[model samples]
Structure formats: C-alpha cells, structure tokens
Target: MIDWLNSTALTVFGVGTTWAEVLGFVTGLLNVWLLIRQHVLNWPLGILNVLLLMVVFGTAGLYADMGLQVVYVILGLYGWWAWLYGGAGRSELVVRTTTRAEWLGLAVAGVLLTGGLWLFLDRMTGSTVPLADALTTALSLLATYGQTRKLVESWWLWIAGDLIYIPLYGYKDLWLTAILYVAFLTLCVLGLRAWRKAIG
Candidate 1:
C-alpha cells in the first residue's frame, strides 16, 4: 500500500503527482468541509488525510510538516471529543470568540514555538525551509487548538498558514498539494464567515 501510494498518479506541468497526494487531497477537502459544518467526523477524516500527507512531506524533506501530521492526529482526537462533549454539561461544543487572554497567549505561544521548532529543524534536520515550515506549523497548532475549542478565530490562523503553505508546497514541487492549500484557503474563508454567524 505504501509503495503504491508513493507511485506516480499523473504528470502535471512536469511534476509527478503521487497517489498519496491525490488521496490526501480528497480526504483533506472533505475534512475541512465537514469541519466548517461543525461535524465530528472531520476528526477521523483529517487523521487519514494527515497520515497520507506525512508520506508526501517526508519524501519532500519537509520534516516540520511531516511532524505536524503526527501532532494533528493527537489534536484531532481531542477535537473529536471536544466537539462531542466539551461544552456546557458535557454537551456539544458551540462556536465562540476567543477571549483577550486566550488571544494573547496563543500569539505568544505561536512566536515562541515557531522559534523553537525553527531552531531544531535548522540545526537538527536537513530542512532547507525550516523557518517557513516552522512558521506554518505554529500557525497550524494554534489554529487546531482554537478549532478544538470551537473558537471562531481558528479559521483566521488557518488562512495565515495556507498563504505560506501554498507557495511552500509549490516550491517543493508538490503541485497537487499546493492546489490543495489553495482550496484550503478558500474553505478557511468560507469557514470563517460561517463560524462568525454561528457564534450567535
């Protein structure tokens, strides 16, 4: 299965897109689509998407991104339960805005964590795009945490990360994944709009 998934799916603009990228693209789209509608199933779907992308990123030497997929799985589990029960009286979670304190803490954590990961990826790994990768990773972590809490601001963080990710994936010659991030950018915008309304 691993070998098959790593094999070329098609050649597009001289880039040999892999089956893993193709499958990840589909699951990733559905995962985000479901999340926008506040569905619990997005968690399992997202886990699958990240696992496939782990292979893609590992091949591309995007170590931070490959590692990010591992963390996403952990966060996905928490998010799954959060959506189902992390609410008043262990009920379903609802959309909410981040408090000022939460915003400040997330900002600080993003900066600090990005620095730490960037340093590690720079010195401890062969990651040429460590800073870019680390920045996106931090943003993704913040976004995922906020999303798990049903925070409306999570989509904004995803938007920021997607902006960087599109070009990064393109630079890595992962054309399909670049396109996936473009789709993610669009979905993040729509999700933000939808969640804003859901806050009421």
Candidate 2:
C-alpha cells in the first residue's frame, strides 16, 4: 500500500501524479460529505485529508496552501471539540447564522490576512500563485472558523474560496485537488441549503 501510494501513476500537464494524491482526493471527498451531514467524524477524516494534502501542496510549491493544511489540522481539532461541547451546558452545537457585525469583522480580517500572506508568500517563498493562494487561504480560515461555530454562512465562504481554488489547483497541476474542489463547490451549495433548513 505504501509503495503504491508513493509510486507515480499518471502524468498531468507534465506533472507526475502519485497514488498519494488519489488517497487525498478520496479522503477529502469523505471529509466534505461528513461535514454536509453534520457528522463529528468529519474532523478526524479532515485531519487525514489535510495531512495528505500538505505533501501535495508542498511539492507543488504552493507554500500558502501547504501551510493552510497545518492550520486545518488545528482548526479540525477545535471544530471537533466545539461540535461536541461548545454549546449551551456542554451540549452539541446547533446551526446558526452570522450577524451583520460578525460578517463585517470577517470581511476586514479576510482582506488583511490575505494581503499579509500574499506579501509574505510573494516576497519570502517561491510560491507560483501567491495572491490566489493567499486569498483562498484567508477565506478558508474564516470558513473553517465559522464551521466550528456551526454558522450557516460558512458554506457561502467555502463556495467562494472553492471557486478560486479550482483554477488555482488546476494551474498548479494538482488536478485531483482541482477536481475535488469542484465536488466541494457542489457540496457547499447542498450544505448551505441543508444548514439553512436546519436553522429554519
């Protein structure tokens, strides 16, 4: 299994793709599916998915996305705990909507973080798509945080981020990841509808 995962399977846009990317793609699909179902198991599966993707993005020289995987690990753990006990009297968290003030704060923070990360990546790292990666990374942070809070609006942020991620990953030759984001975009739409119904 380990040998197969490390072995090159196909060439995509002059880039050799391995079974590792396939594994990451499968687990990523599972993670998003679980999230849409509001299942707590998504966290552990997400952790595994991100670990695989850390290698994928790192090798692709998408430094910002590589680092985003690390953040996802931390956020996954936090979301796990929050979903289980970060509710009233230690109950499971329920779906909720963000307030206008909260949305404004998130917007400000997203812009600032995207700018900072973009500068850092463009100046310090050998990143090929710094601006796009930084923008998606910043928005993903907000989306993940909102997911932890069980906010219905997080899916919207995810949809926005995934829109950029599809082309970015495709340009980076992470075709599996790009395809995964396409699936993620569809899932985000369904997730938003489901969460909205839950809130209603």
User: TM-score for each prediction?
Assistant: 0.98, 0.94
lDDT per residue as tens, model 2, 1-200: 55566678777667788777888989999999999999999999999999888877777788888899999999999999999999999999999999999999999999999999999999999887889989999999999999999999999999999999999888877887788999999999999999999997
RMSD of 1: 0.7
The digit string of per-residue lDDT tens for model 1 on 38-96 reads: 98999999999999999999999999999999999999999999999999999999999
Candidate 2: where are CA atoms >4 Å away? 1-6, 11-15
Model 1 collision count: 0
Report the number of the highest-TM-score candidate.
1
Cα RMSD (Å) between model 2 and the true structure?
1.8
Kindly report which residue pairs in candidate 2 clash with one another: none
Quote the lDDT for 197 in model 2: 97
Give residue 109's lDDT in candidate 2 (0 to 100): 94
Which 10-residue span in candidate 2 carries the lowest summed lDDT? 1-10
